[model samples]
Target: MDLDDHGLTFSADAVMDETEELRNPFPSPPSHYTKYTTHNLDLLALYNERLPDRRNESQAQILADQTDVPDWPLTQLEKPRIDWILEEPEPYYDVFGERWFVKDKIPSLGEGGGTQLYPEDPTVDRRPALLGILRSLLVTYSQLTSAILAPPPSINLSPANTEPPKPEWEEKVEWITVLAQNLMAAANDLRPVQARGNLELMMQRQLQLRREETKALHDKCDILDAKLNELRAAAQLISSRGDSTDVAMSDPTPTKVVPDDVLAEDVLRWAEEVE
Candidate 1:
């Protein structure tokens, strides 16, 4: 693996297993194809050009050792000789196309009932492998015909079923019942305490409200007291003004000197008026 700024990279092997994946990278169909658009046609052409060439089975299985799993190495030479004659000649392609090809029947070879043997490797006896395959098939068939198993599958736990056994279940139920009863008793016991807490909270809330009301009243009193002080000052100013005014009436013009002579004459008249 080579590390680069982008990411770690590795050389891709000629892994023919992903042959189908090459087609996936091709351009997809356009949304509207009612009419031929130049872009769409161009894309189709490009897609055709990019398509990988079809490979023969032998060539596809590059690692011959690994390809033996699917491809027959023996198929390289020629199709095996079959004795039975068919009305139609079997079709075949040299490059291993969609269909396998069979050559014209060689009337020279007689009917054979067994699998083809490796003539070169004469020491290879296929009887043992055939018997082993037959045994496996028999075992598989027997298992398929056997009775159905209805056993419940276990989840995360392995020791037992998710549901406990009867005795353990009963014990659990009893314990739950006792727990519920205890819970009920405890709730019953806490009722008075809970109520007391609630009442205390209410009392505290009421006290807070009363304090607010008192503060509001005090604010109003302060306002009124200020108003009263203003009024008192105004009243004091009026009283002082009235007290500073003249206490007795005074003549505007000066008293005349003839007033004495006139007063002597007026005194008799005044005495007469008084009498």
Candidate 2:
């Protein structure tokens, strides 16, 4: 049987042509084609499925809905929040662990041998100020507390030294430390008062700025109104004058009646330039 006649055989030239046509031009796939082709396409399909429809809403709206927005994002937005924090701030000593205080380096006193007063008043004696006294007490209290808490020195001695030390010394030192801490707490408490005062001052300044801006806006509005009125009067004058032969003869050129919008635009531009 003839293989070609039975459709089971091909010519040698035809086979070569078919092989060349079907041959891969590249040894390996192109970078872009292979880049993510191996990655699971189902991941993207799943992500698209999970995403919310945002046809009616904008991407910004969608993201905003998803994200937490601060109540006071800007300083201007928090203008009226001075008395907002009604609850008295909890003392730092109460909030923080005593270990933090213990680990913290003791804050140094005023410069110049740590005895310099707040004011260098020549008339007043070189006595320590109230702040200085508090600072000194705090330092002394902390030192005493540290020393009291220290482990007793190692020694091989008499039975008298073997007794566990009494708690009386620790109790007294703790009391003194508490007093110093209270004094320091009071000093810290005064800072909020100053902050509140500063806030009030800022509020007043903001109010003043707003008032000035309002006044400027009102003045601009008045000027625009005056200009609009002038334009209207001019238009009326031109219309009335159109009926008169003498006026028509005196000026052959008819005055262009500027549109209200055009006149307003010019006025606004002038106002902006002046500002």
Candidate 3:
């Protein structure tokens, strides 16, 4: 049968025999007659002219190009075809008017009846990474608390010694501070649009406040250390003078301990706010 009689035409010089019926995944609808042709329809040239890489291409032009020349390497040959047959052929296009051409009949995992143990994007579910970071941070904070409860290291409070007393909580504080900072960064990176309600900003602000609090604690500890040093020096001077009178040294100022309860409360508040 003449392919033209059926309103369909293709190159007789194609690798496939023209006598055999051509395979058309997108068969024209019976109700809507389609006159497929390739005359003067340089699909590549038309695509280059109309659908530029970074230009406003019309939807009609893109769909026409995709339907005519689906493959790029094989689109060089101008095979037999026609022009417009139906007012609107069934085709899908993106918001940018780019046509979505079908290359294969492979069904997606959703419809193929198969289990996708892993998603295409590993970070699609960031809960695992976020949870791991949070757990590490919690453990670090717990260590800081324990270190605070632990006895301060022995120090020689001598004016001549010139050894500045380091606070026991300082190391632990730094660890927790670094961990908290990392957690905040990770949280921000993994923030989903659906769950976002200034949550990333809140986390950033909270981390900043935590750093400020830590700095204040460090300052307080320094002041206490200075006072303790002065008292020790006074006692030493009195003893050197061979004074029989007892030189009573004043008690060192207490350092503020960061409570884990406060941290827990803040986390709970964030959760509630998000909810």
**Which one wins on lDDT?**
3
Q: Give the clashing residue pairs of candidate 2, or none.
A: none
- Per-residue lDDT of 49-165 in model 1, one digit per residue for the tens? 433443433332433333223222222233334543343466543321133446633221112322221222325563464455446545544543442233433446456556633
* lDDT per residue (tens digit) for residues 51-95 in model 2: 467546433343453333222211122223434333335212211
Per-prediction TM-score: 0.28, 0.30, 0.23
Query: What TM-score quantifies how close candidate 3 is to the native fold?
Result: 0.23
RMSD of each: 32.3, 32.1, 39.5
At residue 64, candidate 1 shows an lDDT of 32
**Clash number for each model:** 1, 0, 5
- Regions of candidate 1 where Cα sits further than 4 Å from its true position: 1-174, 239-275
Cα TM-score of candidate 1 = 0.28
In model 1, which range of ten residues has the least summed lDDT? 108-117
* lDDT values, one for every candidate: 0.48, 0.53, 0.56
> In model 3, which residue pairs have backbone atoms overlapping below 3 Å?
36-81, 36-82, 37-81, 37-82, 38-81
What is the Å distance of residue 22 in model 2 from its true position? 93
lDDT of 3: 0.56
Best by TM-score: 2
Better of 1 and 2 by lDDT: 2
